[model samples]
Target chain A: MARKAGSDGSKTAEAIRAAGLRLIFEHGYEGMSLRDLAQIVGIQPGSLYNHITTKQALLFDFLVEHMTRLTEALDAALAGIESPLARLDTFIEFHLRYHLTRRMEVFVNNSELRSLEPQNRAVVTGLRRDYERRLEQILAEGTRSGALNVPDVTIATFAIIAQLTGVVGWYDPKGRLGEDEIIAIHRQLVVGGLLPIP
Target chain B: MARKAGSDGSKTAEAIRAAGLRLIFEHGYEGMSLRDLAQIVGIQPGSLYNHITTKQALLFDFLVEHMTRLTEALDAALAGIESPLARLDTFIEFHLRYHLTRRMEVFVNNSELRSLEPQNRAVVTGLRRDYERRLEQILAEGTRSGALNVPDVTIATFAIIAQLTGVVGWYDPKGRLGEDEIIAIHRQLVVGGLLPIP
Candidate 1:
């Protein structure tokens, strides 16, 4: 919502971003418009423009924020866990949990990506590559340590991720199994593909 | 691209769908339009409307076409394959390969799905559910025979699929691996998770 300019501007901007994300994730990038965002946030149309540069900026932020936050958390979780296999486990579970809670965010990340301008698309894509690179490193470490056996760590990393990204399209929080059970099953699935023989 | 009635009229319809698919897959459901498809296919804009009732119908076909084909192929592939694990492997590899080779179709099946109207959406989704039901049956059969070890077959089906679907978003024909090799690796990855204790 629009608010007093000076110190309160940032709050308005944040609110607009959140409201826009909810709409875009539900209606898709095509269905949602700036006016819709403004109405949702209870702000004047002109005032909404002040908070964000353009609709693309709101979408770009919506798309990348989840990955940005998750990768940072993944970095922290992977920090001291020296076991490569364990590291992979942590990453998959973290990914499942992230997608489970912010499933809409995951949908936006997968679908609304191309709506971004060329430069913005590259930045968001760069973040994805960064995450893949980290996973590739962990996988390479696993191969070296005799904990995993797979061909081409980089390829495997991407393959594993594609498997996980589908969660957003289908995961139901109110389903028969709770989130932890889903995570546990995914861990086994991922590990089955990568883990090495004793 | 418009042609005579009867047989030629069907061909005209195919041309329109092909053009729509090319634009939509490259762009998105929102990115392409009837005029664009007509222009790309070298047809008059008015003539385009003759083949299809509306833009949304084309969008629905875009989502349904490949999936309908794949389901047929899957049934063929899985038929009479006694080993549950073997059937699962075939499903995984076939999915990865199909998406890799026919990327436009893949994009249509995977992401442009939301553009369908409610009944059309249900039809396509039901087709997808049918495919998954087969996989779950196989998984259940494997578990029943002590051929695969898993606490839950249903969730595992989704997990396996997520990994397979991710392949399309990243796979490049010119990249280090060919489709067959990628499928082999996918087999290794999938088998690791689904196979019973070795």
Candidate 2:
């Protein structure tokens, strides 16, 4: 249902989504309860329906929204980047910065895939495959132009994505390494991995 | 307490561990219950205490046991490997093969780390650090000897581990690629990433 303009419904809906993401990130989707979620959002249990109809819908929305934002952001980052190697560099930088700042989304997206029901799971998986395909196309382009020497484009795609996204698992903003330093390290690891060996 | 030799108690203990792993893998640590675990094992809830004292203890044991066994296995894998490059190759092969066959362990190890109690979490985290140090040392030695050229060994260590351990998330036993092919892909990505560029 659509919320009327100037109504509190839109704000409440956004609050519900933020609360749901935090709860699912801290506790798995299976472990979070509607009662706790409503409490966190400062609403009555029954009133939760005004924002989210069901817990399953909340989870599906969370995953779909995350994947949608990721793909759109990537497309924005890759815009006007013509060289395949340069496109790959943009991907590595974009993934690390995006994931590091959005740890909740990254954790929930990766860990809660199993909690999604089969139908919901299929949709989320399809979105993820589309994201992977973007990187695979870049790798294929690089291989064709002799700019990269990946033994297999598909494996390289998965490995590079994994390596880049891993920053979320251990990155600390106050830690020794600065953002640029971490990004540069991963850039070298990824770009160097794809370079033609002499 | 120790079970009597040759008694069903030993078998029951093994069964409890196996059942616990499955339940925790399907449901988060917080989402699983001793009552359900007992029901799955075909035993009374009270009898679960005979195998595991409490759920917290069970979670701790699960994580600690997983980390402990992983370190021991790594030690065995790297024994008597003298060359830094060869040792790095052994690390890649060992990590990929080990994680691929133990998808449940990898999932629980990565996902349920948040569920571990503070003291238990520290112990498990320390064990993991020790394991990472094995690779860090190998990388440092290679850099000192001018055989490897990692920009930052610490970041490289985390990135490489995450890249290698990620195989468990998507690998399929009946898929097009066999185990050897998967290993070669990762080995090339890692070793090629580290080799000095001429």
- lDDT values for all models: 0.79, 0.90
Kindly list the per-residue Cα lDDT of model 2 for residues A1-115, writing each as its tens digit: 8968857988889999999999988888888999999999899999999788789999999999999999999999999999998999899888888988888888889888888
Candidate 1's displacement at residue A152, Å, is 2.4
Error of 1 at A116 (Å): 2.3
**lDDT at B50, model 2:** 82
TM-scores of the models, in the order given = 0.91, 0.97
Which portions of model 1 miss their true places by more than 4 Å?
A: A1-8, B1-7
Report fnat for all candidates as fractions from 0 to 1: 0.65, 0.60
- Cα displacement (angstroms), candidate 2, residue B114, comes to 0.8
The list of candidate 2 runs beyond 4 A from truth reads: A1-4, B1-6
Return the top candidate by TM-score.
2
Docking category for candidate 2? medium
The lowest-lDDT stretch of 10 consecutive residues in candidate 1 chain B is B24-33
Per-residue lDDT for B1-198 in model 2, tens only? 996887788788888999999999998888888899999888999999988988888878988888888889999999999889999999999999889989998888988889888888888899899999999999999999999999999999999999998888789999989989999988888888888878
Model 1, A1-198: lDDT tens digits are 675657577777778878888887656676678897898888888888677888887887766776688789889878888888888888898777766777667777877776789999999999989888888998998888888897778778887887776676777778787888877887888887776654
